[model samples]
Every structure is written in C-alpha cells, then in structure tokens.
Target chain A: MRTRHPFTLLTLAAALPTLAWLLPAPAGALGTAAVAFGLAAAAGVRRVLVPAVVTAAPFWLFLFVLHDLPTTLAIGLRITTMVAGFVWLAAVLAPDRLVEAMVARGWSVTVAYVFAATLSAVPLFRARARRIVEAQRCRGLSPRGSVAKRLRALRALALPLLLSALHEVDERALALETRGLRSGARRTPLAPPPDPALERAARWALLLVCIAALVGRLV
Target chain B: MNPLTLEGVEFHYPATEAPALRDVSLAVAAGEIVALVGKVGAGASTLLLVAADLAPRITGGRLTGTVRRRARSGIVLPTPWTQLSGMAFTVWDEVAFGPANLGWPGREIARHVERALERLEIAALAERDPATLSGGEVQRVILAGILAMDPDVVLLDEPTAELDPAGARALWRLVRVLAGEGKAIVVATSDLDAVPAVADRVAWLEQGAVRAMGAPDLLAEEATCEAGLGTTVAGVWRAAGLAAPYPLTVADAIQRWR
Candidate 1:
C-alpha cells in the first residue's frame, strides 16, 4: 500500500475526509472514521494511529462541552475523520515518492521540489535541533537555567543551526542545478514508484464516489 | 583544457570583516590529484569552495577572478552528516540521489549506484539505513553519493575527517583511481602523511591565501616545516636534525637512516 501511487493514496486520504463532511452526521461520520482508521492500521502506520486518536480525543471533549451529546458525536466524528485521514497519509507517504510521482506525471519540477523539500525540512531541522541541544549541553550552556539563561541558550543553539540550514538552501540549490533540475526540464524518475493502471482507476473512482455520495446526501 | 582552473581568485563572505581567500591560483588537469594542506583556518576549505564554485555562486560571497570549469563537477563537503539527502532511507538510495536527480533512466541509475558502492567498497552496506551508519561508513557513503554523479572534476573538503585510518587509506586510493580514470580531483585535507603518496601536487594555504604550490615533495621543504605544514615523517626527521633533505614518508626516513 505504501508503494502504491502517491496520488492514489492522497485521493483515498482526501476522499475519506470529504465524505465525512458531506454525509449526514453520526452514522455516516462514524462509517468514514472507521474506514480511515482501518486503512491506517492496515498500512502499518502505527506511529501515527495513537497520535491521531489522541489529537481527536481533545476535540471530542471540547465539542461535548459546547454542545449536546448527539451533536457532539456528529461534529466530533467529522473532525476525527479529517484529522486521522491526514495523519495516516503523513505516516505512509514518503515525500521523495510524492515528488517523483508528481514529476513523472508531467507536473513542474519546482512545484514537486517545493512540496518535497518542505515535507523533508521538518525532520532535517528536528535532527539538527537535537544535535545543537547536545552540543550546547557539552559546552556547559545549560538550557535548564532561569528563563533568561534558557533563552540565551536557545539563541546560541538556534543561531548556528539557522545559519547552517539557511546556508544549505544555497547549497541545495546548487546541488539541484548540477542534477539537471533546471526549471521546466522533465526529470526522468530513476524509480518513479509504480503507478499501476489499477491505481489510476482507483483514484478516479474515489473522486467520483465522493461526488456521488455528496449528491446523495444533498438531494 | 584544464578540467578545473582558478586564477587570481579572491573571495569575501558577505558581512565578514576579512576575505576568506585571496590570490589563489591553481589548475587541475584530468588525471591529476591536487591536494590543499593547511591548518583549520588556513583557507583550504575556502579555496575548495571557490574551486567548486560554491563560494561566490551558492555561498553568497564576492569572488573576483577567473574560474574555468571545463566539465561538470561534484563536491563532497567535510561534514558527511550534513550532506546527506535526508529523504533517502537506504544507502543505495542515498548514493543514487544525485543520478536520480540528474534524470538518468532507472536502469542507468541502478548501474551507477551499484558501481559507486563497489568502488567505495560499501556494496555490503547498500541495504543499511543511512541514519544507522557509523562515522566512517557515513563518510564512504557520502563519497559514493558524489562519485555516482560521474562528474569530470571532483572537489572534496576534508574528505577523510571522520574516517578511520583504513577508511582514509581506501579513500586516498579511490582518489588516485578517480584521477587515473581522467577525473581531475581537488581535496582539502588535514592528513599530511597521505599527501605524498596520493597527491600529484600540493598547495599550501595560509590565512586565506595560497602561500605556495608545488610537487608533493614540497612537504619535505624546511619552509613547510616552519609553517607547520610538513608531513609527519618530515617534521619528525627535521626535529631530529637528521639531514638537510627531510624525508616525507617513513620509507624515505628509513632510506635516509641507511
């Protein structure tokens, strides 16, 4: 499933949330949420499942506080469907495959690059942040001191990482240039994750099913 | 044509009080390995960045001089940890990143990636997660990544900084093999002992300037010793007052003793 087309996975992820919103509450919302969670479990994105449920749990509590029980269940399930669907997508979707899929399908390389780079920058920054914290601790600049001292430690930790990572933007640009990622050039995907014909059919089917259900609910 | 050339090149990083490199002129033809030796702040890295076109082009610095690159180039910066393509999960994929980005066909990408793995003697590591690699393994992986790009000129900044002695020896041999294959190679390194055996020429940089450029035997020069740029054997021989011509390697020192 992880190896499936990125757009196909995206379609399923997006459809689950849309259907939950379009359909009548409680029963319909619960159904979509169930399917999304099931998909998440099946995909083995165990890292995200607990967080997705925990994240939705707060919303349920808030909704119940502001509304009656039935209404709370209705709105809360819709929100849960929206949240869990995306969380699962984030867990399963590798950014590189997304970029490759986008470029392989004739999308602009710059757009794919921006999306992939942004997705990847998070983990890269997080890893660097950890290193900086460790290095600062070794240097005896305690981050556990008073607020002002902690703030200074943060500044010390942040400045080098920000400068280094910012400098990487330029280096990455040059790296991209050398790789023939010149604007508008169609980069051949060394291994564009297999987007089988069935997956394309499934993707379109997902979109149409969402539209049909939306009409069914409205009418 | 020189595979890589820099003539009268000077560079100053933006907002800096002083230039990082000045009056650095050098040429590297295909089949030649040029090494830059100096202390931590000796402008060796700066000169490499200039040669790799990172100083002025990507680094936001002022460069005044001629830089002629006759072919495509790849740079392997010092920190292998920072240079990784964060998206790659496996070592194979990491090495393939450059060729994949270059839009090579899938089969061709695989070919290049595998060959690079073999060359770097990391074929067994192709399946390992890059995040789990040791410092030396990471260094080799980074070199493999750059080499898979098939560049005509390779610029390496402190390429062996994190390697074990054996790994460093392998890397130096790889450099020679690359040069034999007609790729011009420029390396900025602190490993003076390996310079005599690996480098065809050496440029001594000091305080952001190329102070001297000559054959690898320049390591035996009294001037190099005075500047703290002498190879280990040469420095030790000079300290012992062995002879006027200091030996740059252990073998040479033995011959001198005989």
Candidate 2:
C-alpha cells in the first residue's frame, strides 16, 4: 500500500506537456475539448466540469465578446483538462506514497515533507472551514442571507479559519521538530514501496511517448 | 541517577514584563513520577517545557541558570490534535512517526509501535484514521506516539485535561505503568485527586516558583487545603479535623482505615 501505482502519476505528469503541444493551433480547439472530456471521464472527474464551467464563465464571456471561438474553446478545454488531471492525481495519490516516491527518488526529506504537507492542506483547510462555519452558525450568524450579509458572514468565517491556521503554524513547527525533521538526518521509511520493474518500464515508456507526441506536433 | 535537574532556573518570555518561571529548583530521579500541580498561569507548563528542553529551544524565552535532562526526553503537549501527523491516514502511521524519524530499523519501529499501542490499550485503533477519532481517542493515540519513541524521560502537560473521569483514570494508570518500567515521568496537571496515586512526589508551583515540594501529603496541608489544591481525600480528612499529616487519596484512606 505504501508503493504507488507509478503509471498513474507519471501519466498525469506527461499529460500536461501533451496538452500544451496538441492544443497549440486554433483548429485544434475541438481536439482539446475531446481530450479534456476523455481525460475527465477516465479520471472519474466528470462531476468537476460543472464547477469548472462555472468558474470559467467570465473567461468564456470575455472570449465570446472578442469573437474568438477557437481561443475561447481552447482556453476553456485546457483549464478543465489540467484541473481534472491534477484533481484526479490528488485523489488517487496517497500522501504517504507521494512522500515515499519523492524520498526514494533522492529528493530531500524537507522537499518530500513540503509536498506531503501541501497535499494534506486541502483536508486540513476543509475541516477548519467547517468548524468555523458551524461555530459561527451556533453564534447566530445566519447562512441564508442577502448577498452583502452572506459576504459578511463569509468574511467572518475566513477570519477565524485564517487566524487558527496561523496560530497552528507555530505548533506545527514544534511538532515537526519533535518528530526529528532536522537536516543531515537519514529518515527511515517505515513502509518503503516495492518497485516492480514492469511498472517502472511502463512509466518510462509513458514519459517517452508523451515527449515524442509533443515533438511530433512541434515539427 | 536524577533524570532531570533544575538549579535556580528562571525564565522570562521574550517580550513579557515578568518572568514565567522564577528560581525553580527540583530533581527527578529515574523510575520516579513527579507531578507539578498549580493553577492556570502558575508556570507549571513553563517548568515542564524547560525540563523537556523545549522552552528556550522551541519557544522563544530567556533563560537563567541551568536546566538539565540526563536522558532523551519526549513531551506530550496538552492538545493531542496538534501533535497529529497530518500526512498519516491511519493511527499506526501516526504512532510510527517518531520512531521513523529516529531512523530506527523497520522491525524495531514496528515492535515499538505495537508495544505502545498495546500499552495504551488502543491496539484496536491501530488502523483507524487519527482525524476521525474523538478527543479521548486522539489523546491516547498521541500518548502512544510518544511511548513508541521510547524516550527515557517523558513530560506531559495537562495530558488528561480534556478527558472525562474514566479516561483520565486510564491515562494515569498508563503513567504509573511507564514509571514502573523505569521511565522518568514528569507531568503538569490540575487533577489533584489522581496525583497522589500516580506520582511518587509532588511539586506545588505558585506564581512561577516552587512553593512546596514533598510527598503527596504536602498537598494535604492546611495551606494547600485553603488554596484549593487539596485532593478530595485530603479535604475529607481536613473536614474531619484530622492532624496535619493525612491521606491524600481514597486508597490511602482505605489502608489508613484498616
């Protein structure tokens, strides 16, 4: 369980450059949309399209006003594709596996910790946000309100969330130090993932194929 | 040998007007349990932090005189949630964090983690997510994490402050077991009743200084009683117009009655 499915993370990393190459031309806008939908479906993140569309609404409107259909579709597809791919990676990649991969691949423990910390940040912030909201609600801050009032409530929620997170930063530092995260110390991997040659070869081949695809598109 | 020694130790926060700990001196030997008893803001926490080498090191504080630990130390803070390894998805990984950091061999780390979980009676929780556990569960998990590290000296600050009576009793029992195994245990807590049973000695901290230090009976003195530091048994003994020397816990009263 500590070892990652190397093919998954490596394939996602490769997708970024492939997107850049295949979506370079205006005529390739349709191709980019197809790729975005296909990738989203493959990653089981078709649910994100609705939210992504909503988030990119302003850009879509701006592109429409400028009469740049190809550019608008290309930008929209790229944004959705990248977000879907990253979100999928985040979902499937256990933080411990990511840490193990990075450390096993010769990255510093500090760097691996940073990567792991960032990955864990989402859930941490979500829990904090939920707590803040609940506390505020208990204190009679209504969730259902006018736009301005809702904004005020959101501001109230944000303050406590940010404040608590900032306060916790100090404790987090002490906790990390107590766990012996100092420099020059070799960290023992409690669960080093077993590396199978077949998986490694597949990952390398995926990388090569992605690069070839990009170079072919460029030339 | 004394596992911890503080000689005329005084500490002041970096920007504070008054010292947090003042002229405190005490010694705790190996295999002994010492409880620091005080009201909130009475410097018990500061003293524990200093003894754990976290005050001046991790916390920005000015120190005077000498504070020494004769062996490796582990400090379990008050809020167990803050001590969690956020990257860990399961309790076993959380407990393994310290040993893994120490670079222990896989087998050693596993042995220690399993022993710690067993000691805390949380072996069933080994595969549970730390973030999903309740406060009491989290506290036990944190204790397990520290115990897995196998530090010679263990310091706990208000370890069971958030726990219910049953949970507190269980935790105190674990503390006694650790002391029995030859680990020096120093704890700061407001639970006076549990102190006499679990601690070999007690230090009363008042306004950042050691106001009294002796056997747990010191907590039964008229002064301590008047100051509301007396245990329930001590209060009962005093109410009965008992002599200055009295029992400090229920078990003591039971034996004294016999």
Candidate 3:
C-alpha cells in the first residue's frame, strides 16, 4: 500500500473528505470516516489511528457542548475523516517520492522543493522545539507550577525557537541557492515512482465521483 | 582563467552599517586549495559566500565589488542539518538531490550519486534516513550531496565542525583529492593543524578584511601566532621560548629539533 504512487494516495485521501462534505450528513460522513479510519488502521494504529482519534476527540467534546447529539456526530465524523485521511497520507507517502513524481511531471524544481519542505517541516521544528525546552530546563527555567508560571516558561522556550527558526530560513535559502535550486529550473527525477495506468484511472474516477456528488447535492 | 575571483569585494548585509567583507581580492585557479583562517566573525564564511556568488543575491546584501564565477559552484554550509535539501528521505536520495537539480539524465545522476557516496565513505549509510544519522554522518552526507553536483568551484564553510578527528582527517584528504581533480576549492576552517598539510595557500582575515595572504608557512609567523591563529605546534614552540621561525607542523618541529 505504501508503494502506491504518491498521487494516487493523495487523490484518495483528498476525495474521501470531499465526498463526506459534499454528500449527506450522517450516513455519508460515517461511511467516509469508516474508510478513512480503515486506511489509517492499515497504515498503523499506534502511529496514525490513535493520533487521529485523539485529535478529533477534542472537537467532538467542543461540538457536543455547543450543539445537539446528531449535529455533533455529523460534523465530528466529517472532521475525523479529514484528519484521518491526512494523517494516513502523511504516514504512507514519502516526501522524496512525491518530489520525484512532481519533477517527473515537469513541475518546477522550486515548486517540488517547497512542497516537500512543507511536508517535512513539522517534525524538524518539533525536534528543535524539544531541544529548546531541554536547554531552558538546563538553564533552570522551570516549566512547572501555576498556569501563569508555565505560560511564562512556555514564552521563554518559544522565543528562542522562533528566532532561531527565522534565522534557519535565511540559512536554508543560501543552501538551496548554492545547490542550484533556482526558480523554474528543470530537474531529472532520479527514481520516479512508477505511476501505473490503473492508478491514473483510479485518480480520475475519484475526481469524477466527487464532481458528481457535488453536482447532485446542488441540483 | 581562474574559476572564481573576487576583486576588491565588499559586502554589507541588509540594513547593516558595517560591511561583512571589506576589500577582499582573491582568485582561485583550477586544482588549487585555498584555506581561509581567522577568528570567529572575521568574515571567512562571508568571503566564501561571495566567492560562491551568493551574497547580495540570495542573501539580499549590498555589494560593491566585482565577483566572477566562471563555472558551477556548490557550498557546504557550516551547519549540516540546516543545509539539508529537506526533500530527501534516504541518504542516497539526499546526496542525489543536487545532481538531479542539474537536470542530468537518470543514469548520469545515479553514477554521480553513487560515486559521491563512495568518495565520502558513506556507502554503508546510503539506505539510512538522513535525519536519523549522527552529526558527523550528516556532515559527510551533506558534503557528498554537494560533491555529486560536480561543481567546478567548491566552497566549504567549516565543513568539519561536526566531524570527529578521523572524519575531519578524511575530509581534508578528500579536499586534496578534489583539488587534484581540477576543482578550485575554498575552505574556511579553524583546524590549523590540518591547514599546513592540506592548503596550498592561506588567507588570514581580521575584522572583515584580508589582513595577510601567503604560503602555509605564514601560520608560523609571529603576528599570526600573536593573533592566536597560528598552528598548535607553532604556539607550543613559542610558548616554550623557542627561537624565531616556528615550525607549522609536528614533523617540521621534529626536523628542527634534530
């Protein structure tokens, strides 16, 4: 499943949530949510399923507090589908493969690079944030106590991380420039993941189904 | 013609009162290794950026000088993690990133990437994720990535900052090999012990200006030693109240003692 072309995985992930939103409320959302969860489960329950549910659980509580049960179920399921779909995609898709695919399709090297960088930035920043937190603790900045105290600690931790991240942006730009990643430059895909005809057809079918569902809803 | 030349070049970063580099004139011909040595913030890194034609271009600084680059250039910045393409999953793909960007054919990219991986002695790590590698391993991977691009002029800014002693030695050796292949190289490093053996010439920078330029023996001079930029052997000899003309390396010291 992980070996599938990146575009096919992306299309399915995108289409599931679109269908959920465009179709009916409870039944449609439930079906899409089931498929999304199934995909996430197949990827890994601990890595994808648990996080998706944990992320969506807070939304369910907030919705239930504001609205009735049925409405809460409807919106909660749709949001869960979107979250699960993305989580699963993030797990299953390799950024390098996606980049190769984009370059093979004649996309600009800059566009390919930005796409891949955006996908990978989260973990990179998270690691840096953890280091900053550790450094602050070593410096005797306590992150415990009352909410206000913790907030002050958090502020201290975040300020340096933010400043360093901004500085990193400058450094990354210089690195990229020296590597010949200028705008509009064409690149050869070293190993473009093979996109089969069946995958292409499936992607088109998924797009058509979403269009059909949207038109049916409007009409 | 020299592969890279900076003639009377001065550079100022955006909205800065003082220039980062001041009146730096240097030229690197084919198959030459020029080492830049100085105290921190003395503009060795900035000079490499100018030589690579990056300052005032991607760096958005004001420049007042003639900078010429006759061939392709690649730079391995000081920090390896930040220098990552952020587009590679495996070490192999990471090293291939630059060569692929040059629009070479697939077979050509593979050849260069494989050769680079071997040259850097990182073939065993080709399948590993770059993010999971140690600091020294990542530094090697970054160097392999730049080398795969086959740039005519190579600019390295503290390329061995994260490397262990053995790794640093291998890198200096590789720099000599690259220079032998007719790739003009400029390295800014504080590893003075390696400079006498590796560098063909040395440029001493002080407070954003070229204070002096000469052979590797300059590292044994009184002024360079006084500035704390001299080789370790030279410093030790001077500290021991040895005579004038300090030796640059241990072997030179041994010869002098005999």
- Which candidate should be chosen as best, given lDDT against the real structure? 3
> TM-score of the candidate numbered 2?
0.87
TM-score of each model, in listed order: 0.88, 0.87, 0.92
Instruction: Report the Cα lDDT for residue B49, model 3.
Output: 83
Worst-scoring 10-residue span by lDDT in model 1 chain A: A173-182
Model 3's alpha-carbon lDDT is 0.91
Q: Write the per-residue lDDT of candidate 3 for residues B35-108, one digit (tens) a residue.
A: 99999999998998888778878888799989888998888899988988888888998898887788888898
Error of 2 at B113 (Å): 0.7
Q: Could you give candidate 1's per-residue lDDT for residues A1-219 as a string of tens digits?
A: 788889988998899989998888888899999998887777664577787888889998889899999989889999999988998898888877887778788887677766765765687689889988887778887647689888877788889988988767765665554444566766666557887789889988989999899889879
Model 1 is docked with a DockQ of: 0.41
lDDT of 1 by residue, B1-258 (tens): 898888888889888978898888898999999999888888887787777766776678698989998888888877777666665668997898778777788889888899999999999998897878898899889888888989999988888899888888988988999999999999998899999999999999889888888999999999999888898898988898777689889998888788
**Model 1 misplacement above 4 A:** A41-55, A94-96, A117-121, A127-164, A167-182, A209-219
Worst 10 residues of 3 chain A by lDDT: A135-144
Per-residue lDDT for A13-95 in model 2, tens only? 45663654474654454455455545555545445444444554676677778867776677765655555445445445666
TM-score of 3: 0.92
If ranked by lDDT, best first, what sequence of candidates would result? 3, 1, 2
What residue runs in model 2 are displaced by over 4 Å at the alpha carbon? A1-11, A21-66, A137-157, A201-219, B237-246, B251-258
